[model samples]
Target: MSQANEKTDWLHALLLYGLGFLLFWEWLRPLSIISDTGQSEIFILFTAFLFLLSYFQLPFWLSFPVKGIAMVYALHEMFFPGSFFDFLWLNYFLSDFSQNVGFLFDGRFDSLSNVFRTFLFFILLWLISYLMQYWLIQTRRIFLFLLVTIVYISVIDTFTTYEADQAIIRIVIIGFILLGLLQILRIQEQEGVSFSKGRFPVYWLMPLVVVIAFSSLFGYIAPKAEPQWPDPVPFLKKTTGDDGEGKNGNGISKIGYGEDDSQLGGPFVMDDTSVFTAQIKDRGYWRVETKDVYTGKGWESSVRDRVMFEGSTETLFEDDVEVEAFDMKMNMTGNEEFDFIVHPGQVTSIETGKDVQLLENPLTGKVFTQNLGESVVLDNYNLEYESPTFSEKMLREASTEYPERLADTYLQLPETLPERVGALAEEITSEEDNPYDKARAIENYFVGNGFVYETTDVAVPGENDDYVDQFLFETQLGYCDNFSSSMTVLLRSLGIPARWVKGFTEGEFVAAAGDYREYEVTNNNAHSWVEAYFPEVGWVPFEPTRGFSNQADFVSDYSDDEASNTETSDPAQAEEEQAQQQEQLPQEEAASGSSSAPFEWSMWYTVVLIVIFLLLCYVVLKNYKKWLKRLIISKYKKRDDDKALSEAYFRLLWLLDLHGIKRGANQTLREYAVQVDQKLRTKDMKELTRRYEENYYRGKTNNDGWDEMKKLWENLIKKMQS
Candidate 1:
């Protein structure tokens, strides 16, 4: 073999083994490194072996599609969590720009840019590989080797973060292999290694078999799928002296109820995952709002609704329920559509609440709702959920009949306030309108003004009675919490029934399989909006924070297109500026735009595929000419008979073993055949045994013996099928 031929010969095998190992390594690593154990390690080893076997039979090119699909699915699950899978297809095409896309709500193009950029990057890399291979075929140099290695290492480290799951790791590994192959191809071309079409070899089947076997093994042994589920309850809110009934070290109360733990609010720990989930007929605030009278450690829900028994009436335990003109009904059924029912606090009455018959649960309060067809009366005398859970009375009640608790909260306001803040509120909203209109006007003012939205870093809360004044007049930026709190207090100061409501904004719905729409809620998605009570209109929500008004009419004022276009233009414009500077100087060298070192085909499979493809093409286009030249020049080009016999013997033995025939480790070919015939149960086995004997013991010199032996194996296959 020529020097060039020898140089590129090892690339295929080297890449195949390297990628197979990488796939296994990635699979062994768990989401959290702390979870890694012996089980994952053993599985990885087995999987790698299976892959090796599968690749031995299949073409390197064919294995990529299956692997690529699997990798993409796994990686997407790891990074984006809830929202990640919804836009998975975007990731496939826009890998390069994924990091810079920002949040979905930030801007549309900002999100999509990464995905598109990644896809473009991959394409460019592919093109580079093609060019590099074309160039490298003519020359090989030491600098080339070092450059290739350095580039490969840099690419892997830069793109493959620890958080990336097994699938993405596989992609990275496979990509490297493909690039490496192109480099090898380039080297081969440069070294002037020449070969005739007839001499070209095809090992596509070897890798194909190995990859298939590996994938199958992985699937069979893979662990059961586990869907992410929320913890049953939010982090325990308080660790008071443990009451004997309580399990934790806190003695506050036997029953875990009333308010969240009080020792220290865990900014990290979340509320009960299920707290936000309830089935309601209509969308509204989840009445977590509790503050008997704001004690200033942040407003909290003080009263706990007693859980009513199944099919009980609200009349049983009503102190007094607020009456309304129109009977309101809310129901909590099983985990169906709209799993959680959330409403404004101070809900004095219940009617048409489903599955809740009003029987009381001693522990959790107000668990059930009164079931009154479409309308139930609020026990106005007692003011329990629509008094008389099953009364036939058609009495019209005023919507303003609120419980004392509700009235007290609405009327509540901080004792101290900056004079300028109150003046500003009054100035923004005229006194001619009702409290509801005033509240709306104030909300509109805050949203319309130059107040910014973001979580504030401020620690001082009691600086002024009018927190809104401080925010508006002093600090300009605060998160949704700050914005909503300021608005709530201001509305209360103005005699409007305003309260802070905590819930998440609706996330984009992902219509996955069937009619199910998966909702992905994140910490970034948690939000607070202000609810202002109008005597006639009931309670209405208003988000006062700029760029995030809760009103439906509040459209995004920021332009996504402009933001993305401007961000994308910065680099291009900079390059253009540089080019202009260079243009002014007559003798200056033209500016070269930034170009990444081209990716060479590093994958063994891809290299193997390219090699096979080139071989096949050569065989088709120049086989006859090559054959003539070989016949006239090197007569030894034909494979050696001895080598062919050894190959045929080993192949036939492996084929027999595949059919369930056992072969002893130390048995020779002739000995194995004799053993096969003695144990043979069918004519096909006997024939196979005879063929092996003829090829091995009889020294059959006919060049066609290998062909005959192959025919016997085919017959055996047919017999097995029959």
Candidate 2:
């Protein structure tokens, strides 16, 4: 091989393996695999293997389509959780700016940017892999760079991950594989190898496995350290920022609650992971953080002040506010440190095993606790709530006097909120006189309209879009957060004070003793509900979400109103009238964009199909020579024994040439066979040379035993290899 070809081969090998290293680092370092248990690592390994196989089958330039297609899918998954499978264009990202020809520079690409972003990501992965490979291989100084990178990531992962669940094992195994690939490339460079000539040698793989085995054994026996860094991941907030429940932890929550991702949040998935178990009576949802500030992205709890409370006191309800009182006790689980999931009512007194700091928003009665030490035994806590008794009759007549301070804090709205939100709120509450009626009107819109209440997959709002506005006027699909946050925003838009509250649901009533009821609350029961505050009535808990028909006396009010509307009408054709009214609501919902066009998913299966297709291509490339030889054997199979002898003789010559002992162009067949006999130090090819001369020049048929010639041919092949 020429020096230039050797240089290119080394570069190709370096780029191919080096890119694998970078991709592994980018994926593993930033994210925690504890929840996933190395799921992301498995995916990385699969993609890398697929990538290398493609490198072997196609020329470097065409390899992009093989990997780039999969990357586009990944990018789609990032922007919209449920949409990696959605294809062509999902109208959400097709904003005004992205339609231009420039693609990246104009910045108005909106959702369309995802396509370029993924393509650009693949390009970057491709370029950096090649660039690093070429630079390192050219300098013969590649291993040190990879070695430092491996150590850096190992140390970071060591210090960063909280659980550290078998991640080091993955890292160690990956290091061995990478080192093996690097050395294999160096070996190829030494041999001046070319792929088209024949099969690659497998001799280097033995040492690779041996080294990996020893390294893995050492890893198993290494001494462990008591981690001094934070127990929780440090860069967690950034990593989980996009698809996370901010305070609650990673993965989807089922009990229909999450950490304020959005009003119209990402896909709702059920996490059956048990969040906690609660023992209580007077079933009501737990209220933790009340997000008073609404950014288009999601809800934010602006109440950062922590009031240190001890003994029988915590700043909860104001003295003047009247409420019914009830005492209760419960324990919090260790899914994460308990940040206080309390009922909607105020805590009169509380106790805990760990020293706790109490934080409360008196106006909203939303409370939080900071645990001093990581306690595992569901630390026992007791508290009395100054709860309120409410009926639709009492709430409608209750005073709407706005406290100046309370009004400023509770009625907060995002400034970028569209005009349609306030307009729609007014339109819904046009016939209602009181704030209670107005709140009910907005809540009923979600329950009675064509809105869907789903826990696993919810509507994803567009960029620069207000979550509440999107939920109300556009896509009427979501879980508890969507329904509750929209109702709160609508209530605030109508001058009614409402806040989004999150915590566990009252939970399934497991067993009851005397006055109290025992309930089991899993992470699946994490729920969000709205608190619409009335001046004399205090903050009344409202279950605005459709599927959750409990935790409120007011939820049944809308059902009653629907029934009473017909009874009071005294119409002869009441059934027909009710059916007509129901039909009108869904029609209005459709006009308001409650249902979007059903997504026409491009053949997303094509990514998988393409992977399979490329794999088949690799298989064909790997075995093409063998298949071709079989074809040649069959072609000569029908002929006589002479042709078989000639075929065997030619194969020996080809093997010799493949092994770089090519016969000179000017050499006759006799001369070549004689030279091979000398190289083999045997008389094997001398008899074969005499037979070939007779067959070719004298046209003499070799009727003598062909087995003897075959043995000679086999010996010559073995000799040339040695």
Candidate 3:
């Protein structure tokens, strides 16, 4: 009986420890997403170690030293570089600890080092582990902890990017199972009943498991209602006065075109919501606006000038330039409405099926639709434009004599621009003679260099740091904005007339519509590039972004010579062929980008093993009680007569409880026996209870009427089973 009680206690401790570890793990999982915490695995292992010590019910004298050693080892693995017993690390640790202790006394929490902060976190876990044990064992209650865990996950899910969908599901299941088990234990304690050979009452557990499983499945499969209230994120931002416009705030903005270009550098999450679609014969960049001034951090227009035009015929380029006039239709997706028209190339005319006036900003090249002196949103519009194709001969032969107004306007730069930027520009364009070659040299410099195209991890410039200088000299990592802005600044530093351009790329092709191809443009296609003004060439587009090809046409001098050898004489056919060739380049570049790095098979193997181990644990935990009960029953049946009689009486009590014939706490042995006899319609329980009392209280364990006692026990067990 004592051994069975000890085993039951061990099993209970193990269950408590497992549940505690799971709850603690939920807390650590979001740290990496919401903060800069690293080496989370070490923290998880340390938590498991602490819970294991609690499970063993170790003495404080022994457990304290073991836990201390484990914490020191974990800290060493996470932060230290030398051997485990290195004196240098110990000395550094002691010095840092002293400094942090002073900081604590001074209330200077922000000045704490990583090592000292980690030590405090370890102590926190230690206290939490002790509290969990106390709640599980002494009070047999964990509702407060479960409630806090739910709140923690929900708050992070609301404020941060941590998706708590699976976490919420796991918590609900674990919490229900834990509450049910704790309730059973509480009842057992109240009734002064030990668990039957360390096995839970399977009948009680089965209903709990079935209900939880069915409810979870139904909840997952049921259709959810759409949110009736407006999203709280924008409301929260508005209350905080963070419009996310310009340099007023440092928050991440949604991916789309905005009027403000004063702040450009920061991480942005991808928004795949469709903006609009275009139907055109040829693919081209959709120009929105241009910024002439580089303020060392971001782009902004120096002039807020507007020019009203009557008709759609607005000539933006000189007559000497070569351009082809084409027509395209723009259809808004209705997901969002805009007052401005997104056009390809210079606009000549617009047909909106309404008598609306057009507002054009000559300085910024942005056009807006107005009705009755108020901005109007259009659902569909037809536009005519001239797509310019520049010749390499004209670009190479164009003189450096710049127009006074153009140079002053497009070559604007901040006074705080770094000096190293000009030097690097010179070094890169030294081999080139003409402006076109010089621009190409700077544009192609980012291709094979150490620069990387990343969106999320890009760094925002510090107060003392120039944005272009940081990307070029320090980080060398960013997305389209970084590459395009750097190229514009680099050109300005070299006395070249350049401006920053923002718009959407030629979007993914959907299907062919009569004579044109339809393209769907989403927010993900929002892009930026560089436009440098050349003599007699106007402002030509150049794509400096890695993994992207320039969509503008650039004809080589030998193109006419090669055209005679090809069968396709139509200019549109040639243009389509060139577009197809340019499209394939980006795919090839992206594929070759990771070809040099070898795959890590060990990582895959480790992930597979972890998944398998978790599944096995789930299976064993679900059905282990039944297996344990059967083993214990078989062992009891094979015992000697003196021991068998005592074991049989205990089994009888377990069977009565399992069959809902439980004895009340106030009932004595005789009263409980009479009640059980009445329930089973037999007099055997009275005889069995008398024999058990004789052996249990009177110290008479001689097994002298063992055959009759066995017969009575068998009869009662058979009646209960029936």
Candidate 4:
């Protein structure tokens, strides 16, 4: 029996420590701090230290006093020192706290806010340890209940809210916690001091291991819960370039125009972090990167590493007889690690003033800088590209004779692509004869149709449905990715080679830096479009997404047969009409411009949580004695319901304690009640006391006297308040 009790005691202590650690896990995502940060480990180590002191059983007399001393020591070191009771007057702590509270209302996630929230998190974690210890000493199932909360927070932080690392270790911790809880349940269910040898064998843990193994396997294999609207509150944010020491990936790439690999219509939140500044001649599509292969889920570039350009100068689009030479000088100012921006037209040569290298992926036409170990300051570079000018005759003679090696890759479509997609493409382009006409027909279909463009509230395709099919037929509204990806799929269904392209649209031009016009390129300027591969012409950019112009001089005089009648008959006429269209953006749907919001209402959620926490603290402090009395009464009620009058007398003592009327335990019940009434300066509780004494001492049972006793209790309560 003693051994069994000893084992149970040890297990409960371990459970308390584990539960407190898990409570700290909730902050892992929100604080955006990892174990390696050394900041998060500070709190974790202190919490463990406090838990170690009370591992066997909390010394009720010393625990709170010890914690108070620790708090005083911490406060003195953090905010004040060499003074007693000066912390109450320390305006620095209060001012920062108040400012952070205001910032929460203003919807800002600043570092100061994180500091205040961390302080509150530590306090709440300490409370969890205290409560768990109390429950452990009583042999209650509360440890198991708290275990569920830990699991809930774990799932939210790791799977839903934040992409937490150390996944295997987290799973192992949870598995051990489950086994401990099960062992506790087993011990709790036993009847006698001894186990009767019916106790669970040590080998019973094999089943728990199996359960955890299968659970982890299923977690890996299962389709994630893609809610139509996921929980909108973000766990962490990439508001500034300096967040989390610049390590956290905010669902979007920090490397400007470098990569975007998320599924189409899958939601993400980005910040207004300034990625770069490009000096350009015009506000056209600034092509950064292109993707060749089209996966049913999204797009990728297997051909990216193939085309490498190390030389300083190279001519592009040499086969075309007629082209306009576009020469521009630019400087790289952002993301020193990555220096790549959209340069209009086919890049011919780059003349950098310093030692620099450019690697090109010919298949995708994506030029990336190899700035390995080189600090890329505002490195000045001059680039010249031949922007092809296509007339009706030039594009008409262009062939679909795609390179044999490239043909198979570009025309590739997932077998899962819906058959209706091909059929719909044929129907939309039925009036068109050539490939360019068909491509124009598809672009016109998107532009003329009543398809709305929205970034938020996007609905992802069903598990089995194709992304393009769902976008075209069911949800005919999306951002540049949706429009471009669907157009790419439709063009490919007809053997017209196309791929997804991503970069920035010509951003808001801010000022003239030296001789060039400088444009501020933010995350909002991140864009996606389509590149239709023409045999002699190579890959040409097309803005299938409405409200944006061509990135690679895509405006040709050759119009679709259906559009020729409605559109201008010449390039000069087309440019005039485009000017009118740009002016009409305000009157028409500016859906393209209103694509994304950098921040959301997530900070409001954090503020509300803090508000509720403060409210709870206020309640606890305001009625400390009443809460303590309720806790004691609950235990007594659980142990013996026949001692209702004794519970009532304990409540009276707590009430007297609240008024500072301390009565000795040797005082009679009548003496204590009288002292409590006199301290209150109101009606006495003499009859209530007499009835409670009769029921407690005489072992009297009266079912009818309960209502009169309740009346006396209410009167006493009112008298105390008065």
Candidate 5:
């Protein structure tokens, strides 16, 4: 083999490895969007390492241990908190492995721990990396893998929030190049032509490269046609009866307040259409209704008993709560009308132009408007309500003793609810001694934890999955519904009376009226929150969503010492302090003139570290052959014998080939020696070839001045280097 052939092989291997990595990347990219599989970058690095080992043709005995160490490191980094050499991680891995084996036998896949699941994922990636290498190198066929990669990207792009526009372009470029190279290799093999004979196939590859580049650029700049077909996802869902309605009647719902709460989960699209506007001095959550019974999937009312009322109001809260009377007017804006009135706080009285009757569901606190035995949608209405502010001191000292009816209605959890949910709730609230603190702890858990506030790309629970359990442990990314529902269920699991309430957020501020502020509420403001019932303080609203702040006010009475100790205990006070800190941050930065200097330096520091790592890698890869040559020369120089002479002679031939000496496929050893002697202007190659032939082909063990032959081999290597 000549240097040209060796260079060609190295180039082909690098290209194949690159294409294979890109294909694997496509498979891993969707894990972050469609599921809870984080740490995709680590998986990508592991796959790249596997490909590197294969490219070097490392023996399994050496490579397997290296891969095992890498896998252990990845597991430790992702799931454990300890030193790399700590034995505790090993113990935990073994425990998870043993338990998962039992789960596998019982076919309880969902019960598997995340550590075991990640282990399985690593094993799967190992298998895939091996398969990719085999397809790229041994068989010189990757069409099936490429095709599957395209299909995978397409399906994920259509079904999830991931945009695959750039991915498609990348696949096209890589797929074409892979196919072209594989075809070149195939033609070379069939015709018995060495890559050295053609010198890298520039004539074959340049045209292929040109065609691919031109086509990709043209396709990118060309005007694309609109989608020819309607989206089939909805049609397919309807056909398969998966139209956001699960087996237990709980699945994805739309963004606005709807009459049905039977199904809830999955992603929803935002609707910015205006719903109504209110003229009021204060902003608060507009309550529509509450659901008491949680059916493992969603909320529903256990009873439908109705009580009729006139213009006056029904008692919504206890009399001990402090209240302030306020009057507001609501004007409907959207075409879609509803019979229920959206009111803030407890309604004291309602006045409308049309004669109407009000029927309220005591079980659900949903008030309906009726006129002449028929439900009516009021275009405009005046509401006089008393907004109650609960005393935090009273709530903290509130009794756990609940009325039987309230406990039975609010503390309802399905039998199928996972035990982990209750355990997690207890874990979150274990430090808090009072119900108020416990509720605040659970509510704030979502804000500081890894929970994400996302509207699209949310997962719908499977048939056997509980909605709250899925949100808490699996996909911690969702909108208000997920957070509120999970908190409510967690509260119920802890023997607290809580219900899920859905309504509108205080909408965007419009303008200031004469004595009040005018606000415009849109369907985009449709929200849900948790309401835990305190024995004496009534149902208090809690905002557990990641980005949303609770609007209800709480009055706390604390001594100076208590205030100092628990300054951040009040949610509203904490929010106010956070706001004050943010307001002061700019001033503080200006005064010090160095507040942002550390952050700026840290960014540059990270960039420099990354650049250094890449530069080191480049240096190692570029000079590795020279290092290997030095290592070989040092090893064989110490042994001066016939066997060492023969081995050193063959290694010299490889080195000479790397230095561009020609070796024809049909050439004998003497012929190759003549070519090397002509190139290096030395007769040392001929002498070494004669000695090698004598020792290897004739099986002669005579040393025959092996020292002289070693000198000749070293001389030939030195001349070739010059």
Candidate 6:
């Protein structure tokens, strides 16, 4: 018996590990780079780690800690760094808790080095925990195995909200649970510990049924919870560039510890932080960078940094000129209060609310804070910047005044240029007469030709002076930065002042406000475009980025019909009718009424209906069983007492009904009994009727009577069915 128990325990543990391996395999498979070439190496590493975790077996105490660490690690990757660990821990404890103090500490401590460290620590912790339990507690190994399996699963679920979409993980977890139950059942088999081993403890199935029923109910009724926003408390924000290192409020040095903080080489001064967020009616663009002066390396603001006029409340320059209105606002996410004015470059007037004040720059008339508070209110104001026309004409005419440093840097060409690039440029721009026309010709050429837009990781700096030559002639794959950088250098070689422009393109609109949207933006939306100075126009925007191109024909000629067809049809049709015959047919209705119903349910409607009906019948039977179980049966001393007689009378009547007997509506109990007895030719009919009278009047039904009645009724059913 001992040996059998030991074997069963080992088998259960192995099964549990096997189940874990399946779950781990699933987690790795969908996410692994091995599945798709586009996936990152880091993703592949993670999948491997998960596989190892599931394949290996450890004691309950050890597995629990390892699972906890794994869950935390997963959460860490999902959320902002160091943000979701506490929640992960909470989820872990909700699932399992069984670890030695030292083991727990050791497991967590060893998690410091790298990804593998956590796994190693978890293994050590599990081994130590198992050792402690084996030597000190001396508990049954079978029970230990059972406990470990339960704890490991509970921990996995608590930390990760398992979705049905991840079917493999779900199946694996379910397998572990079944294996654990099987182990417990095995122990009971040897020891005769079951509540009703002979009867099969059919009630044991009740819990699973109840759980599944509830799960099905939730699946059917639960609504999809949409994402929501937090509280709308107005916050003050100090404006900083994408790299975060920008000038402070006092403009002494860059502030806010921006993305370029390392480039700053030191901590930012607090005074450099300015309250830039302003309360407005809508969203508008804030022009933080103006690339005017171009050296070969980069662009900077022109030397004319003087303010034009004192703070003017009006945004319009002239009274009669019709102006385009672009109203906007900002929602700050930090705490700092101010009552200063805020306006875009085209503001014309002021409309201050409460204790707000507008302090314009003495030289340029640009707005700033007067009291230097955190939160501020800016009213109507009119402003303007140097137009693209003026910037271009100035660049063309002022050749002698050009910065000396910009000569070699911006105009430098590659030593070994591909002659094809120059030929391609010349061919594309052969029709255009001037430099501006030629530049436009080059941009149009790329947009119309076989050029593709995509991001690439390999952007090594050129060894020679001509980076543009390398990009245009050699590697054709690169991101927005590469494209614009190449374009700028090409234009400059033709004596046009061009520079790379780094800024986000237009943002996605927020329809709720009946205008554009905000807060939906993320870090990935940052972009790069090119700015070329024309003699007539200052610096015209030339967007060669992926999504911002103005060339319409180059984009795939996708019609609404095409979109509909793509969505509705199979891939085969998409190939056959590539450009036409696009239409979306409404999807066929599901049997259960929802679109998300599995295909099986739609295919087997009759079977599903039958199953549903059976389920309803079972529920009604279960409820009726509860009422029957509530009836108090008692033992009788007499062999044939009034209670037994009464039960026998009812049993006979019930038997008649099972044999296609139906009592007439007009017949009383005694009458029905007489008719039944007459059909059956029973001699004890009168006595049975008298017993029924006694049962109703004297109330003498007990356990013996109920048992006799049940036996007789069951026999009647069997006979009728047969």
State how far residue 19 of model 3 sits from its true place (Å). 21
User: What local lDDT score does residue 655 receive in model 6, on the 0 to 100 scale?
Assistant: 49
Please, what is the whole-model Cα lDDT of each candidate in the order they appear? 0.42, 0.59, 0.77, 0.59, 0.77, 0.40
Off by over 4 Å in 4: 1-258, 269-271, 304-318, 335-341, 371-380, 512-516, 551-577, 580-722
Error of 3 at 690 (Å): 69
Pairs that collide in candidate 5 are: 250-263, 251-264, 251-265
> Residues 123-191, candidate 1, lDDT per residue (tens digit)?
443343333333333342224433454454444434333344434535443544444444544544678
TM-score between model 4 and native: 0.43
Clashes of 5: 3
How badly does each model clash, as a count of residue pairs? 111, 7, 2, 1, 3, 50
Worst 10 residues of 6 by lDDT: 261-270
The best candidate by TM-score is 5
Taking every candidate in turn, the Cα RMSD to the unseen true structure, in Å, is 23.2, 14.5, 15.4, 21.9, 11.5, 21.1
Model 3, backbone clash pairs (residues 3+ apart or across chains), number: 2
Clashes of 1: 111
| Candidate 1 off by > 4 Å | 1-164, 167-175, 185-292, 295-297, 301-408, 416-424, 430-434, 446-480, 503-527, 535-538, 545-722
TM-score per candidate, in order? Answer: 0.35, 0.45, 0.52, 0.43, 0.54, 0.34
Q: Which of 1 and 6 is the better model by lDDT?
A: 1
The TM-score that candidate 5 achieves is 0.54
Give the CA lDDT, 0 to 100, for residue 536 in model 6. 26
lDDT (tens digit, per residue) of candidate 6 on 1-722: 44455544455445444444444334333321111112233333344343334333334465456455554554344211223435754444333333333445777642132223334434544454444334222332333443554455444433332323345335434544444455455566678783432333335545754675566557657896664853222121222232322222211232221212111111111121223333332332332233333332233333334333243432222232222444455443323232433333344444343454445433222354433444454433333321111122222333333345444434544445445655656676678666645665666545423243433222243334234454465545445555676576567656556655443333333333333233222223344566554432233455554323421111111334332222212222222223221111112122123365223212135334533554465456435433332231222213355355555455456546645667888988777767755665553454455554665677766554444444433333333321
Instruction: Please provide, for model 4 over 568-611, each residue's C-alpha lDDT reduced to its tens digit, 9 standing for 90 to 100.
Output: 33343355346544543332223224433233222235435534
Question: Per-residue alpha-carbon lDDT of model 5 for 1-722, expressed as tens digits?
Answer: 45667777878888789878886787887665555444667787778777776776666776788778778777876665436678976886797799999999999986666677789889998889899889988999989988989999999899766779988988999898889989988888888777545367878888998999999999999999999999988998889878756445644434687877677776665556789999986678898888888887788888788788555454556878877899999998675598988888888788877888888887667788888788899898989988876777888999999999889888888899999999999999999998889998898788645576766557677789888899999878678888999999988888889988889998876666466777788877899998998887788888888656777766664444433343345655466445544543444344445456222222234334544554565567667767767777789888865477667777887887787786899999999888888888888778888877776668766365467677787677666642
lDDT of 3 by residue, 175-202 (tens): 8888888998888889986656666567
Q: Candidate 2: which stretches are off by over 4 Å?
A: 1-28, 31-62, 79-103, 106-119, 135-138, 142-330, 333-378, 381-418, 422-499, 504-689, 705-708, 716-722
Q: Which is the winner by TM-score between candidate 1 and candidate 4?
A: 4
lDDT of 6: 0.40
The lDDT, on a scale of 0 to 1, for candidate 4 is 0.59
